[model samples]
Target chain A: MTTIGENATIYREQHRVTYYECDQTGRATLATLINIAVLASEDQSDALGLTTAHVQSYGVGWVVTQYAIDVTRMPRQDETVTIAVRGSAYNPYFAFREFWIQDEQGEQLAYITSIWVLMSQEKRKIVKIIPALVTPYHSEAVKRIPRLPRPIHFEADTQTISKPYRVRFFDIDPNRHVNNAHYFDWLLDTLPAAFLLQHDLQHVDVRYENEVQYGHTVTAQVNQLPVAEDGTVTTSHVIQVGEEKCCEVTIRWQPTTQPQA
Target chain B: MTTIGENATIYREQHRVTYYECDQTGRATLATLINIAVLASEDQSDALGLTTAHVQSYGVGWVVTQYAIDVTRMPRQDETVTIAVRGSAYNPYFAFREFWIQDEQGEQLAYITSIWVLMSQEKRKIVKIIPALVTPYHSEAVKRIPRLPRPIHFEADTQTISKPYRVRFFDIDPNRHVNNAHYFDWLLDTLPAAFLLQHDLQHVDVRYENEVQYGHTVTAQVNQLPVAEDGTVTTSHVIQVGEEKCCEVTIRWQPTTQPQA
Candidate 1:
């Protein structure tokens, strides 16, 4: 197994900030930040010499089970931010990964940890994480595999919250799954663009535990108000399938960072 | 007119190199590059403070009547490239803009020139460039606006070639027109994926002169092929609408700058 030492492989995702990603409010939005984080994941996989085909070769692919991100500060439009990621652990079922966003000074501004399930691409059903496939990463900090607690007392709060959406075909990326950033597209579209554009989602603490199949129902049940901070509301949402928790997203929004003149 | 000096605008576009744009070949796919160029055009409009809402307020919106671009080099994966654009000319009938793409070292790689029409977005018909809207950029330079030749030599080649495609609703971006990148998607999809992945398309020279309404049939006609220094084919094609030249595309393939690794 690969370990993070002088010899362990660590992938660094380097990038600079651009204007288009910034809104009238200057800070990078949570959606945009998630998009960048996904890129870092791809880059990390590339560093492992894993191409798109390699991921698909197993007849399975990684689906973001969840993203829990904490942002201490958001970079401005012209500023640079780097996301570095490493495959932290893997069990029989899920591969655990940790990601960090740092400024030019190397100060970590945000951290995100996520669980990924191996799934059959064609059937879109969860598959066991092949021991051989994930066996290589155990050498690096093989500690307790942090179980992403299915939100305690987590209930969809409503069986009638059927958030109907037409899945855009192009939303399916080369990986043959909806690009994880697109999940925000599904969740955010329920809000007005004017409200979304003006506010910045500062912290995203989400747990994705289940897979939503193609041509199936995606019902987002907002359980409750998770937190209230800085004049914006934070809601806890879980996509459901009757008795099972498919996915959960907790988003916190605050005033957008003002744009630079 | 919001002139930088005496010109309404003397400007450069956002040079972006997002990794999400590159395909398995480690180069930005033709479709992604074209889409970014479209974003550059949108940025130009945004900088001019001419938003879609602002244009719609006048009962007209500028629709891409045509586009012709010649790509001399395809930027490598993760390389930032710039597109320089300027107003070529404008009249009561139509408006024209010219653009060029360059590397960080200022080496020109792509040249694009397009014609746009102020159209009523509601009724789907052509109209004149709004005078109040045109007043801002029309100057002495615009007075002697050059009649850069439109896509010519259409009547000589009547041999027909046709391909049918369904326009996905997502193909329409925020602008409500089919995203310009979708044109490249249509163009490239006609060829075998193996042909696209194995061999590099080094140069693309294309011109757009008309609009393809939703669900319109597009026929790609190859008119000529010129031999290249490296023993590759340079194909020139024109997409036509009966008697009208909608677009002309000149592609030079097997460019030498491809990464061998």
Candidate 2:
């Protein structure tokens, strides 16, 4: 097994936010933000000699199950930001990873914590975390799985606005499944354009329950919760493939001081 | 007006292809390839002090009307490639730009030629090309407008496979219109997954007819043409919003030596 010092567990890279990565507001979309964080972890894995091919050689591949993200503000186009990731801890079946984005001045922009599990490629079942896989990152081995926040429960009777989407071919990643980041697009896109343009995302909790395949038609259902005393609004979203729930997400938003033009 | 020497017309930047930029075959998607080329031209504009903001200061913005791309092969994930763009020539109403992607060994991978026009941001009408704008790029001022090949006419009576798509919020750019690259996704997604995995794209001719807006439900219609004697297949695509035709594309594909697993 490849070994690394504990101090080298964290990996960081600088990236210039390009126009295509941003939305109409000139700010990076939530999906792009999540993608940047995921890429950071992949970079860390590459640096530690634990490439995806190496991990899959044991007939298993890593898959993210959940993510809880906190954002101060979305990075704007043309801004150069730093993305950092570190393997935090791993239990028998789950691995915990942390990712953060910072501006050039080192001010934090967004923080994300994610849960990943190894799945058997042949049987498509969760596999036990192997020590060799986690050791190179110097992650702590713990018996107790950490409890991250779960997405707010979606009420079945609540009034909702939904949008149906046909999975595009490009949405499939190398694993031949719709990418996790694309889920964010479908979830957020169901919201009213006015609300999306007027509010800034503060927190997001998302959980993936089922894999979505190409050519599958999925519906993104969203319902807004009562506004908090602080004027913050929360929205709950679920992506469904007919009767099957594919993913759920809850997002908190604060009104922007200057709404997009 | 900022005057650049003719020798400085070409601009080049190196980019590392990331996993998120690739599809199931581990090759960069057509939309991502086009975006990279557009970004390269934007970088060139920035270098010449002819930034988008500077151009928009005159109440006009550049809009790409057509693209003709020829690909040798798609760049693979994790490969570092060089993207280069040059402002070739311009007339009273049009600007022609050329872009090319090269592998690490400097072997050409793709070449794209595009036509751009300045549009009045307020009136949304085509504006005459200002000499002050093209002068900064050192593009040749010519009287004749270059006649590039147009996308093959899509016959109305041809049987087509069609897919409907809702324009997502993230699809809009800072200009509040669906970005040009997203159309490629809608155009190519209508093809069968088996065909996509077995064929390599050789050429793409796309022309944007109208801007697609947020919340618009668009349909992508595609029909295959007879295969060439050389076994190359051609497809014609049209993106429509109800009765309005938004964009048209014609793509040629050659069977791959090894189909994707």
For each candidate in the order shown, give its overall lDDT on alpha carbons: 0.61, 0.87
Report the lDDT of model 1 for residue A171. 39
lDDT of 1 by residue, A1-261 (tens): 223222234567666655444433445545567778878877666666565578788888777776777777776555678887777776667677877889999998788777788888889898977765554444233345576544433454553233544333333444445555656545654454455556656677776666555434455555435345547666566666556666667777776664222
Provide the clashing-pair count of each candidate structure: 14, 0
**Local error of candidate 2 at residue B35 (angstroms):** 0.4
**Listing candidates in order, what is each one's chain A TM-score?**
0.74, 0.95
Residue B251 in model 1: shift from native, Å? 17
Measured over all alpha carbons after superposition, the RMSD of each candidate to the real structure, in angstroms, is 9.2, 3.4
lDDT tens readout by residue for model 2, B139-214? 8887765666799887655478988887889999876678879888888888898989999999999898998888
lDDT tens digits by residue: candidate 2, A32-62 = 8988888888888988899988998999999
Q: Residue A54's C-alpha lDDT in candidate 1?
A: 83
Name the top lDDT candidate.
Answer: 2
Model 1 lDDT vs. the true structure? 0.61
Q: What is the docking quality class of candidate 2?
A: medium
Task: After the best TM-score superposition of candidate 1, give how far the Cα of residue B260 lies from its true spot, in angstroms.
Answer: 24
Residue-level lDDT of model 1, residues B1-261, one tens digit each, is: 223214546457756565545554556667766666656766677677776678889888886656656666666655778877665567677777777778889898777666667888788688866766655543223443444444434333553334444443334444545565666655555444444555666556556667665445566565334466767765556665566666776665673444432
